[model samples]
Target: MLKGHDFLITVKAPGKLYIAGEYAVVETGFPAILVALNQFVTVTVKESGDYGSIYSQQYRENSLLWKREGNHMVFDNRDNPFHYILSAIKLTETYAQEIGKKMKCYHLRIDSDLDSPDGKKYGLGSSAAVTVATVKALCHFYNLPMTKSRLFKLAAIAHLDIQGNGSLGDIAASVYGGWIAYNSFDRNWLKKARHRYSLTALIDRKWPQLNVELLTPPKELSLLIGWTGSPASTSHLVDAVGLKKAEQVKNYQKFLHDSRACLKRMIKGFQTKSLATIKEEIRRNRKLLQSLGVLSDVQIETPLLHALCETAEKFGGASKTSGAGGGDCGIVLINDSSNTQALLANWKEVGIEPLDLHVHRVND
Candidate 1:
């Protein structure tokens, strides 16, 4: 199945978890803090004997052929589950042309463990991770000089082209590959940049407003991630909340102020390792999210998620639902590692699955 002198390239990207600043991050220029998890989505590309193809190990699919047609690449069928992959390929082809380069024909294989053994989605930002991996693989395969900013912008474009809405906090975590204090890029600035230069040129030029900084968690603090076994559609929840925010301008503005204050305290708390400060801020943040749910008539903080948070608080830890939070994962932060076992046992009793995740440090 292999040809002599065939080339192979592999690339991996970490999944992300939001620590704070959820709904507010999408407000043009707001920021969110997230940590890249240990779990990764990897993509591999190897020269094919015939036309180009793609295979997904996670999806357990056979190779699907693809070919270049004029200035674009077309797959065997357009109705596949992995539109993320297809979007990456097409976008990369366009990037290559914009930068005056040629793309080679190769077979791409994607693998991910963000899903459970029974195929339950963990709300780990799989689409962002997959897009990052695909872009990295294509850049590596073509020997493109890809930098972190370049990769992030390209992947963000590909993802935006499909989903049409997101704060891009997940993409920032994947590209930076660690705990980060991130502010969303200015939409107007990015629009101008897209019109002014190619992606390659944009990478070389500095916008100065794009804010991404790395942060190290203190040694005393530990995190526990628990899944609710139910998946939440982020788009649906965001839309519901967005519609309400438009109708309740005064309430939304007040919520934003409180959310920003909580996030500021949490960031400082991480630096100081002040358990009391962190716990209070997390509690306030949780309360705001609950209010958002009530205002939108959406279950942003479902009873199950609230129970998990309360249980963690009862055990002297602070917890809240991570991300959009109707039902995916809740993050628990504790000062002592000794509490981990007890927390896990209690979570098990309540049917919450504990995820084995940690901060992922990127290699320079």
Candidate 2:
């Protein structure tokens, strides 16, 4: 049930995904197209008490409510998701001043349900969805008079502020939902310094309506979704890439460039929308990721993942890392669910487990 103050917006933030082409976007300065996943971070806002307060469920798990005064407005950190929501709100408040929508204090209860709670691979970017949703709600709450595109740009900038060096791909995909050619680096945006180097010369561009499917593994899908059990820290990993960037600029950028090309090839191949072509492209992209540091030999393609692919050969599709590959839950795309019973039992025979997921795209 979605409640509102006559203009309340009910929005579901989609999950972030890197289907292909990473590390390359960092320096070689290529474009990467990301898509929004089906699972989401849902938010619902209703009129709170008198002061217009925000009630966050996760924050209540820690403590009830947190209130503080800022340079311009009195803000409250009601919960984890709303905390980021407040950051976006504050920024919007400033932007509103630019036009003429003066905003005062208001109490709003923010409801959030983002945990994989039982600890499944719900993936990151779920909170990012909430951040996006919260920002949209705030825009409506105050009649901020901002367009969706304006709100998206503000949300990306705000997400970076919250994550402390966010790549901006996740937020972009979450907001846009489909496919886009996104590159985080631009000498134009990177620095005010004018460079003779033009982004046009080195880049090849195209925008295609992507066809993504939620692959349902067979009943006995020989799938082993091993949790490296250790979540990699995004900041440290980005720092490591940065440190290496200065030393191995040419080699690293080349890998990313090649990877970006591989992604383009895959997206182009999808024009025919053939399963065989998609699998081959995925294999090529896996090799490219392995060549780059994003997907390592051992970590990205674990013995379990490899063996699972081999076993899934009977069912026959492909497998690869769905995101930054330092031991996150990777995906195995199956051909058809025909032999589901036998295939899934085989997964149990080995040590791998399956996840309850579908590779779905967003509705227009």
Candidate 3:
């Protein structure tokens, strides 16, 4: 039973990223920090007219066929949009039931600016972003509360609904917004715990949040981001690392322990503006990634990325790949702005595409 006329609603959701803390989070059960960028997905909800539907500009392009039964938005097709929207609606429904009210029904137009211009999955969490946006829109439409944790839970549902095994870090980053320290090994997430922490507390309380975040902003770096043009799987690399742990237990343990110490120091260095110490950490971290088998010899020395790193070195900066790097985007943290153009031109010489990322708060 429904009564009121249609109402339009819109909600914005940000993009996902990693600023500091990666695999460490999953292992040590610490928070992996990330910066949510301006890249976002917007969901437009329209009250059901004679007909109802949903469309995504950048993702879930198939305008889902729909039928509005009073206040219910019924699905006519199945896909990412179907499951994600339903998950949001379901949560809203639960809330409505608890409050003894009917949730609003509106046609949804969901879209994004994060899709690869070429329609490829760039290993970024585009779907996760969409899921978060959908959850936010539905929460707004139904006048349901939106807490970072509850929102993350919805996104996780959407993600798990689509791809069974989801990355909690990416979801947490998008839901919380801004820089986040995510370690999947964080006992909290593994234990299904959702305790939250702030970058202010994680970083030096003295570290300037605004300035530190600006480092990974949406600007295109003078560096190059290559796709490796191959869909390299992290599973195999991860397995190899795991297998080596028991076989060469002593060596691998030492490597991990050393790397963890280096990362801790690096986190401190980042706080103190100690670039000198930071450089040592990156060098040691890369070596440790090598030891853990996260980086392959072919990857680190690839002529394209290697050349790019070499070029950045000459310009007083460093470059490396992001994520579980069998093949993924490479990032260059260059200190020299004057040489960016030439550096980019040189990278273009090798067919690596430059990717721009907007960095900001991960949550409200």
TM-score of every candidate relative to the true structure: 0.89, 0.72, 0.70
Candidate 1 weakest ten by summed lDDT: 1-10
lDDT of predicted model 2: 0.55
lDDT of 2 by residue, 1-364 (tens): 1236544455566766665665555442565656565666655555444466666654455433333556555333322355577777766665666556655656544544434554433344655677777776666666665554555666765665565554566666776665455656443442232133222211112212212232322233232233333344444455556666667767776776677677666665555555566567667777776665643222445566566556655667566665565544555545554566676677668765554544335443
* Model 3 C-alpha lDDT per residue in residues 160-186, reported as the tens digit of each score: 544433345767767767645444423
How do all the candidates rank in terms of TM-score, highest first? 1, 2, 3
- lDDT of model 3 at position 164: 39
Stretches of candidate 1 exceeding 4 Å from the true structure: 1-6, 60-81, 207-209
Query: Which candidate number has the best TM-score?
Result: 1
lDDT of each: 0.80, 0.55, 0.55
Please say which candidate is ahead in TM-score: 2 or 3.
Answer: 2
**lDDT at residue 124 of model 1 (Cα atoms):** 88
Could you tell which candidate, 1 or 2, scores higher by TM-score?
A: 1
For model 2, the stretches where C-alpha displacement exceeds 4 angstroms are 1-9, 27-29, 47-52, 59-83, 108-114, 119-121, 145-148, 179-181, 185-230, 294-314, 337-353, 359-364
True-structure RMSD, every candidate: 6.1, 8.2, 9.5
**Model 1 lDDT per residue over 1-364, tens place:** 1112347887788989888888988776566779899888888898765598888867665345576889888664322338778888877777777777766788888888877877667988888888888888887777677888888888887876666667888988988987798877666777777788876677667654567888777777788899999987676678778889888899888888888788888878777868678778878888988887777777887777888888898888888999999999999888865567887888889898889888888774
Summed backbone clashes in each candidate are 0, 18, 30
